[model samples]
Structures are given as structure tokens and as C-alpha cells.
Target chain A: MEGLIDGVLPDAAELPGLVADLRTARSGISFVYDVIEKLAERYELSDAVMVLDHPELGRQAFRSARRPIGEASAMHLNVLECPEGVHGVPGGVDPVSASVAVELCRIALDLDLYRHDSRHDGLTGLYNRRFFDVMFRRCASQSARYGWSFSVVIFDIDSFKQLNDRFGHMLGDRVLQVVGAEMHHALRSSDVAGRVGGDEFAILLMRADRENVPAFMSRIRAAVEANMEMSVGFSFGIAEAPVESTDPAELYRLADARLMAAKGTKR
Target chain B: MSVPASSEEVRLAPLGDSGDEDESPPFDALELEIRRLPGVVAVGWHRGEAMRACLSVGGFGLSALRSRAVQLARGHLDEPLSVELSDVEGVFAASSVASVRIIDILVAGGEVEVRLGAGHLIGTGRAGTGPEGAALATIRALDDLGIGASIELRIASAVVLPSDLGLAVVVSVVDRHDGSEHRSIAYASSVEESAAKAVIEAYELIGEQSRDQAQSAIR
Candidate 1:
């Protein structure tokens, strides 16, 4: 991958724009299209395609060429993040074609890594609201594909603002970290947990449709309560997704509603 | 070898050309230039889609270059991989907890295909023209002082049926290619037995490919 970037950046100062383009891309497909279009301009190529091994979509390609995707010899573009097939660009101009191909790949990966960082809470190192939104959609897709049920659990540190006011933000932060850590440890590999708010955490459990979600939530709650200060408690809510609605927004709304109802019980 | 063995510079184009629709330097050119670099004894890229040029700066070079060599080879890839360069020598998917052990950077076609454990492959010419050559070349691709001829085995999944009536194992071989390829599709009554059967089947398939290569050569 370094061979694609070494020293070439000095002459190809415009390469930064390629990376910048990655930031602007809203989705993976757009990231790929942005690369292909830019490389076509730089390498004087006619067409290209992005073959990606998306976790949900599996091995798939987004082609720009009017003709067949072409053979291996026609492959020009390559990227680091592409796990499966070659990220190739066909009919490219010499030297520039290879360099741009490699740069685009690196840039795309950088964009992804950067994007991932942005979706995580710096303190707890858990997924943030941004990732939650994305993963929720993914869960929808997964559930539909496998007919497996998923659930969303949302909870808040009861009277968290009070904890911050009394214990100083440092201790409050420490408690939040502890809660996040416990949730992380308690989670199954198929689960996604995010610190969506300061003291509020959300989890999406894949394959929990048939299982006792409340029981699972209670386990996590117990783990957190065991580690948390006596004054700090939690309220919880869970909604089964891929059941009534494939949309995560709907699930979020339902979960929030249930969360409020659960808090009412505490009151 | 005319290209200097000591300094192998794989130059890429894409000079932010405003008007040039050119892609970049050809893999063949990069391969040729890479061959010129010092200590680089052999070069092979399968089918051009799978790889590019890799360089291990200062010391580690062969593994770095193998990714780039994959740009020319042609084959089916199964699952993505990240190498654990540490003592664990575990092969995990990029998304998992493990980070890929990448000592150097090379223009790889896809993921890093050369598992340094594959044995005695460093500085050898490309393999996969047939079967035995492919397996041997695979070993040579990651040849180090004491490491060679080792395959990185990863199990994608293992499931025990109700009451252990049957067991299933998906044995993932992370040797040179990434992604899923079923060398042997079989079922067994025991998890241990099933996994063993899968490995044996993969070995048999590789052996057959090698023999076919030999037979074709003799013809």
C-alpha cells in the first residue's frame, strides 16, 4: 500500500482532495464512486467498478463501465479496505493510474477509519449515536435476511445530572466509563452498545427476538449496579425490532416510550 | 534483475492530473520495478485484480511485496483476513478484535494474502500456474529465517447439533488467498472428526491440483 503513496504525494498534492472527497461521501457506495470518478479523471480511464465485501450485501460490485467489468488484466484500481476482490480500474494511463489507484484505496480506508472514530465516544470508547443509527439499519437488514429477531435496549443513569452535580464531573465520568465497560463486557459478540448520551446507553441485541430480552437487560443492569455508586441507578427499556417495524427509528421511538414507562415504575 | 536490487522504487502516476484520465502505473511495471529492488529474487502477481507492489522498508520486505504481487494472480478469495504478526499467529477478520500484523506496506490486490508462516516463499517466482507449484510458491512467498511451510488455520464456525448427533465445522485456511473457498464440503458426526476431515479434504484438493500441474507439465 505504501508503494502506491510514497513520494507520489509531493507531486500529487491534489491527492488530498481525493481524501477530502472521502469525508464528504455519505455512504460506502458514494465513497467508492467518488474514488472511481476522481481516478478516471486522473488516470485518463474510461470506466471502473467497486467490488466490495459488505457485511450485509456480501460480495458485490458497483460498476461504472458500460461494457463488461473486464478481466483481471483490466483491473487498475486497488484499495486497502477492500477485503475480497481487487479494487481495479481498467484502461488507465501509465504510472498515474497505479499511483492514483493506490492513493484512492488508502484514502477510502482512512475515511472509513476516521468515520468509525467519529461514531465512538472518546471516553467510553463505545459506539455513539451516529453508529447506533447505522447499526440499527443494519440490524433491520440482518433480521430480514435471516428471519432472526433483534431487540433494542435503551437506558439512562437515573438522575445522572444529579450525580454530576453532587460527585463532580470527574467521578461522574468515571461511573459512566464503568457502566460502559460493564455493558461492553456483558454484551454478546452479536450485540452493539453505544453511549448515545452522557449517561444514557443503548444496546441492540441480534438474535434476541425469542430469548428473554428483559432478563438479558437485567443481567447488564445488575453488572452496572454492582459497580456503580449507591446513588447512581438506572432505568431500562427494550423494543423488539424486525418484528413490528424494520425501521430503527420506529424502534427507537418505541424503546424510548417503554423507557419512560419503566422510569414511571421507578417513580 | 536489471532493475537495481538495492533501490526498488515503484512509481505511481495519478499526479492529481486535471485532465489525464489515466489510472496509475501498470502492475506489470510495478512488478518489474519491484523485481529490480535489491534482495527481491522473484515476483508474481496473479490475475492483476488481487494485488499490487509491497515494500518492507529498512528490513522487512518480502511480506510487504507479496500483497502487491497478488495484483496479477487469478483465483477465488474467501473471507477477509488480518494477520497476527505476534506470537499468536492467529488469522482473524479485519473487523474482529485482532489487528493485522503488517510489518511493511505493499500495494496489495486485496487483503494481505501472504501469511509469513506459509514457508520458504520469500524471493521466489510466482506460483499457482498449477497446483504443486502454487502450494510451494505459497510457502516461498513468506519464507523467513526459521519460518516456512506453515498454514494459518482459522475456523469460521463450529456447531454441535442436538445431542451431538452431528457436528459441523467451517475450516478457514488463511494461506495466500482471502475470502471463502470450499476445497472440501463434507459432514461428520463429530466436531473434532468433522474439522479433521475438512483439513484433510483441503490437503487432498491441493495435492490434486499439484498433481494436475505435474501431469500437464509432462504432457
Candidate 2:
């Protein structure tokens, strides 16, 4: 009764199922659209606008109605921000169920955001160490079973400490971001990249031989050099699966050892 | 599979030292830290042996809090941990959360007895003298209100704040029944009052959680 007026709210009896459906939605976009679709069907809402500010996906709105925009009555434009407990719908409109749906959608979005954040690096938008390790093991097992070959590339920014000391962490982080963006852009969809350490990054190149990895790294290196404001440089090492070693740990070590050697040669 | 190792500069201590042989895992420390993260409300673990958790979250940094919780759990738990975080934005809002407050404190015969009240409900607890006793007494009083379970005191101390801030009491408590931990600090003229307030502050969320659970069950 607190949120109910003359507008349509989801029937009280159907809320549990609706909430369950929203909870199980695979992603935030699906969740928001599902709510809009449900509202349109249940309440026959002629016009509705649901805006979401997602952490990863940015700002998006899911709107559903039988007519064009700007025609919705003031009653239909009521916004529900659950965290602040503010309801903006005008009097004589029943938005109780819609408000609940919006709140549930927000919750689902938060869950999705956290789930994503948990697996990826905050600064670089690359896989975090935990998830990268997970993918590495999965790839290693599958490659061994199928007798396929893959490559692990381990690299770090050259003189990264000196760069951070001279430029401060802000610029240093920008360099990492640029490097990460380049890696993301240059890598094949099947490949996996992660920010493994402060300045260190690891890439699992699916179906790639050690010999072929240099070509991919070259592209990434060129992109980084072209995009970066400062003259940033990096060194890398690569190891192949089955040929070098199928063991995940051993492959990492092999790649890391080569990375250290490259750094030494650069010095 | 092993977690990818970070540089030594950013590496955390190993998780093997989470708890002692005779005690349970250090969920209290983990919970206290997780709660301090942005957008976290009440957090609790499942009742069984599994290292699963439920967190009530709101505001920004949901991902940071979720990721950090896993990282922190890895540091405190030996087993692989899974966290289930939900957005129960208004569930733990201050509007409904309630806890008993210290109405009176009496020390006699090297023991401390504290009286706490919320509305018409009055609860009393007694323990040996000192900050530890005061904290325990506060927990006992919460139990007497039918709002708390057996609590293990992880830390109870009085410390002087920096920059002439003044004296403060910090109390960390773990609920044995549910395996949730809470920590809070309070500044008071006397150590006894400070400890009591800190414990009371810590239990407010737990109290709200239990009340919500009971209400849900009733509904």
C-alpha cells in the first residue's frame, strides 16, 4: 500500500516468481530488459524507461512501450532509486511492483558487476591473477588431452620501476592501461590475457605455437608504441605447450625465465 | 591450480596461518575487513563446513568488494572460497536496524556488570574486570535480549589515537553460532564504557540481521 496508487504494479501473487526469474538472468542487460518486458506484459505499460549505470557496460536504458517517447504521462516517469528510498512517481499511480522490479534489477546488476570485477583486473580491464590462473590450467589440461599446442607469453614493462619513479603511479598506470588495451585489441578472441603483476602480464595464446607468438606480440608492441604518449618499451618471453612442457607451472616458469633473459639483454 | 603469483611487493601472507589448531578459521578478521570495503553491509558465512559466504551490498565498488572478499578469504581460508554477493540495498538501512545501548555500568568485586536496554527490553551481563570483561559482558547482555549468540572476543583493547584525537576502544567479536565476525571502535572517557559501546556497535548489524531473518520467517 505504501507504494501503490492508481498505476499498475505487478500482482502481489506473481512477485516471487518474477523476482526468481530476474535473479537467474544471465546478465544485467537481460535482467533490465526482462523487467521492462515483464512490466509491459503484466501492467500493459504503454511507455516505460529503465536506465542502468553498469560498471562494465556503462550507462544503458531499456525502454518499452506501444507508442513513441515524450508522450508518457508524468505518472509513468516515476523513478525508483531504492538505495535512497526515493519514489518519484506522481500521486494516483500504482508503481509498487514496478519499483520492486527495478530494485531487483539493480541488485542483479550489482551481482553481475561484482562477479565480473572479481575475475578481472580493475586497472587494466584484463583478467586478474586468480582467473588467469584458472584459465591457464583449463587450457593446459585441454591441450594435453587433445595433443594440441599453445603458447604462454610472459612480459613486463622495461624499467617499469624507473618509469613509475619518474612519472608517478598515475602515468605508470596509464601506460599499463594502454598496454592492456593493445593486448586486448591485438589478441585473437580465443586467446587469454591477464595482468599478472604490477607491470607483468601473461597471455595464453590458444592454438598458437611458440614460433607464431612473436607475430602477435609484434602487433601489440606496435600498438602500444603508437598509442602511448611517452616512449614506453617492454620485453617478452614465450613457451610452447607439449613441445616445451604441458605442465602449467613449468610453462609459466619457462616463459618467465625467458622474460628475465630478455630483460637482461635489454639492459 | 595455483593462483598466479604477484611480485613480492604486492604479495599477501599465505592462508595457512588463518586459525589455530583448536579454533575455527578467522572469519572475524575477514568479515571486519570486508565490511569496511565500500558498499558492504552485513556479511555472514554458511552454517556448514563449506567456505561460502553471503554479502549484502549497495552503492559503488560492488566488484572491488566482491574481488577483495575472495582475495581476503583466500588469505584467511585454507579451502577454495566461493562468495555469493547480493544487492539487498535497503535491507540493512539504518531505518530498521536496532540494537541495545548501554544504560548503566557497574564494577564490583573485581567483576564488571553491564546493563543494556532497547525499548522495554532490558539485558544484563557480568564478567571479570578489564576491557575483555566489559566486552564479554556486552555480548552477554545482547544474548539476554534474545538478540545475540555466544561470542568469542578476538580483541579488546584501549588505545590512544594519533594527532590528539583522544582515547578509543576497539573490540572484535565473533558470533560462535553463525561464525560471523564484527569489529567496531568507540571513543569514551572510561575504558569500560568505551568497550561496551564498541561491542554494542558491532552487534547492531548482527542484531538487525537476526531480526530480519525472524521477520522473514514469520512472513
TM-score of each: 0.36, 0.47
Q: Which ten residues in a row have the lowest lDDT in candidate 1 chain B?
A: B83-92
Alpha-carbon runs more than 4 Å astray in model 1: A1-112, A142-146, A209-211, A225-231, B1-219
Q: Which consecutive 10 residues in model 2 chain B have the weakest lDDT in total? A: B1-10
For every candidate, give the share of true A-B contacts it also has.
0.00, 0.00
TM-score of chain B of each: 0.27, 0.48
Predicted structure with the largest lDDT when compared to the true one = 2
User: Candidate 2 residues A85-126, lDDT tens each?
Assistant: 212222221456655666666666555556655776765667
DockQ list for all candidates: 0.02, 0.02
